[model samples]
Target: MGKLLTVFTPTYNRAYCLERCYQSLLRQSNRNFIWMIIDDGSTDDTKQLVEKWIEEDLIEIKYVWQKNQGMHGAHNTAYKLIKTELNVCIDSDDYMSDDAVEKITDFWMRNGSNNVSGLIGLDADLNDNIIGTKMPENLKKSTLFNLYNKYGVTGDKKLIYRTELTRSFPYPLFDNEKYVGLAYKYYLLDTKFEMLLMNEVICYVEYLPDGSSKNMYKQYVNNPKGFAFYRKELMKLPFVGKKFKFKQAIHYVSSSFIQKNRAFIVESPERYLTVLAIPFGLILYLYITSLVLHK
Candidate 1:
């Protein structure tokens, strides 16, 4: 039978740091997963590095090179190509724990089903510190959204998803834009299925200065359409509270100003909320713009 899980990494010009992730995969106690690398138009030696690794034949690897699209676009291609029943993204700058694959497969086999999306696990730093607080041990299943807003779970956690669900809400691509919030798809999946939670640390992460997480202001300035698209969808979610929707509206307004979309209020799902958010949004827009300019 084929591997039960696919660990995919979407990368662009990260050849220098990609080896850390690759080496970590090689150390996996369980080799029952496939490693798929989606090369998002990297101008570096990424292809050459991956080619060498393929020759080593340490574990199953699938590498696909495509023209530069942002991280979301690379995810689009990865989901399309993945044939495994389950998938998780291990960022180019991050590495998995040696037993992560073993833990994930065993957990899923014991508890996974179509009724639940997949599972959420912990992420640690290089020193083995958990990025966020642990999941509520007594909790059985919860959507990603609830885990944060409702339960007050903090920090970044690892997510494993059913490949089919990951493919369901594809991030929209816009001209000259490279980023769309990855959570756009996750929130949509929440609408359909709640995820199982496991407190085990599965991945180690390092936030590089140039990483998207570190340069969100630049992302906002450069990818307003993508941001706008994400905010609009978040505002439409039914499970979240009005306060959450209002927060989304504020972001939507800010993104609209960046995109210079005059019809933002007319197009918003919550027009009244957007109207109330205009001043805050404008302030946020100026703040983001100032950061980008000074950066």
Candidate 2:
């Protein structure tokens, strides 16, 4: 009960920037958290740097090195190992605001309940710009799906989950497919609960050129099954509207075609929508093909 948060960072060959993340954790005003670093088979000096940090014992540091799995895979491992009541992901390229842990636990302890999922907080760029629109002033809680599709808030937001809730829904790891959408699990949880919204920025993000968000086309090419699975799951969600499901269906069709899954027409939940999307799906298929080939 002493530790309230586990600040997890999943890293793969990000040694150069990893120190920055570690230093930020060291500077946190509150030390009531464990910094868990899951090293996803980095061939660089990442292992040594983490070891040195552990030896110094500046903060509670837990290090686990596993075979190279993509970001989602590392996330799965982190969720399993975290014993804290609350958890948040601080990407290797990102760091928390010095008081992030304090702010999060303070809110949770004051008002959090098992009735809700956890907390939904903000993420800011290095320049301190909130990534998307701020949470609605009157709103107190929202699910991941509704906050975007309903409220029209755009851009990435930091999510802090009750570790138990997150652990209950693990990300599926497809063979040779390391790129499952992390949102897949978040959306699944949305059906059961909502998160208390905190308008304060919890984490600072830096989108490097090599990050997953930047090279998505390549990801779609390399991990079509993952993308297809994500889209298919979205199509099955009961809460989303036709418009949202329609978009998921379109992407599902495209990803299905990427895998050359001939049964996509039959597999789709939105039969007519999938049929209509075929033409657009084909265009998207070709567009992705060109991008993959050109790169």
Candidate 3:
């Protein structure tokens, strides 16, 4: 009965670029959605701008502000507040196609079921080309993990999650670490249920030089606690294969060393694998250190 979808945007110090996302929402042919902005302690005029839009009353808006905690923390706040049946994330720098909401609601109303976790949609660039290969034409539903590992899907994609299911996997915030892989939640969700596959393009993306995607090396060194948590979680997934677990163990070793946690091998979910990866992890640790120092 309430709004069917909440398009939550987590932003920090991007008042200049936030308006484009606002304008795109304003143009939506279907406005059966709420625009919730998680303002991660922006010192800029982000709050003031969102207030002005609230006054305009053109769309539903819910804005919350908290001390800077990066994207994962912002997501933590949004999920706690969202009570809608469905939800999706449109980054502060990205916008949706005008009919994106219309298409999502229409499709879900016709086909959505609680048995599935959510829907998977496509993300495209500003030029309107799909960012990755389209969803497999014959596959009606698939886990997010299988889509990549089994079907060879690549590149960034848009995910629309069931609000409750998304809320079930809150990302663990580590001390002194503000960056965690957002996909950490998605991968966990993959272990529970499959998502309905939809080939429709839902949103547009443009990676900024300062965005996490562009600056992952720094994130790797600075957020070792968060990265280690992500890898440890992935290692525990029951559906993951040994090869995947070995790769995760390697990264886990690397992150643990960065965090100065020396007993990582003994504590690993796959202990023997972690022991095997120790040498490679040492090399990776040095490589990461050199990269950070080189920068």
Most accurate candidate by TM-score = 1
Global fold similarity of model 2 (TM-score): 0.97
**lDDT tens digits, residues 76-157, model 3?**
9999999899999999999999999998999999889989999999999999999979989999999999999999999888
| Per-model TM-score on C-alpha atoms | 0.99, 0.97, 0.98
lDDT of each: 0.95, 0.90, 0.93
> How much lDDT does candidate 2 score?
0.90
Sum up the clashes in candidate 3: 0
Instruction: State the number of backbone clashes in model 2.
Output: 0
Task: Write model 2 residue lDDT over 80-167, tens digit each, in one string.
Answer: 9999899999999998899988899889999899999899999999999999889898999999889998898988999999899888
Clashes of each: 0, 0, 0
Model 1 lDDT, full chain set: 0.95
Runs with alpha carbons beyond 4 Å of true place in candidate 3: none
Q: Which pairs in model 3 have colliding backbones?
A: none
Sorted by TM-score (best first), the order is: 1, 3, 2
What stretches of model 1 exceed 4 Å from their correct place?
Answer: none
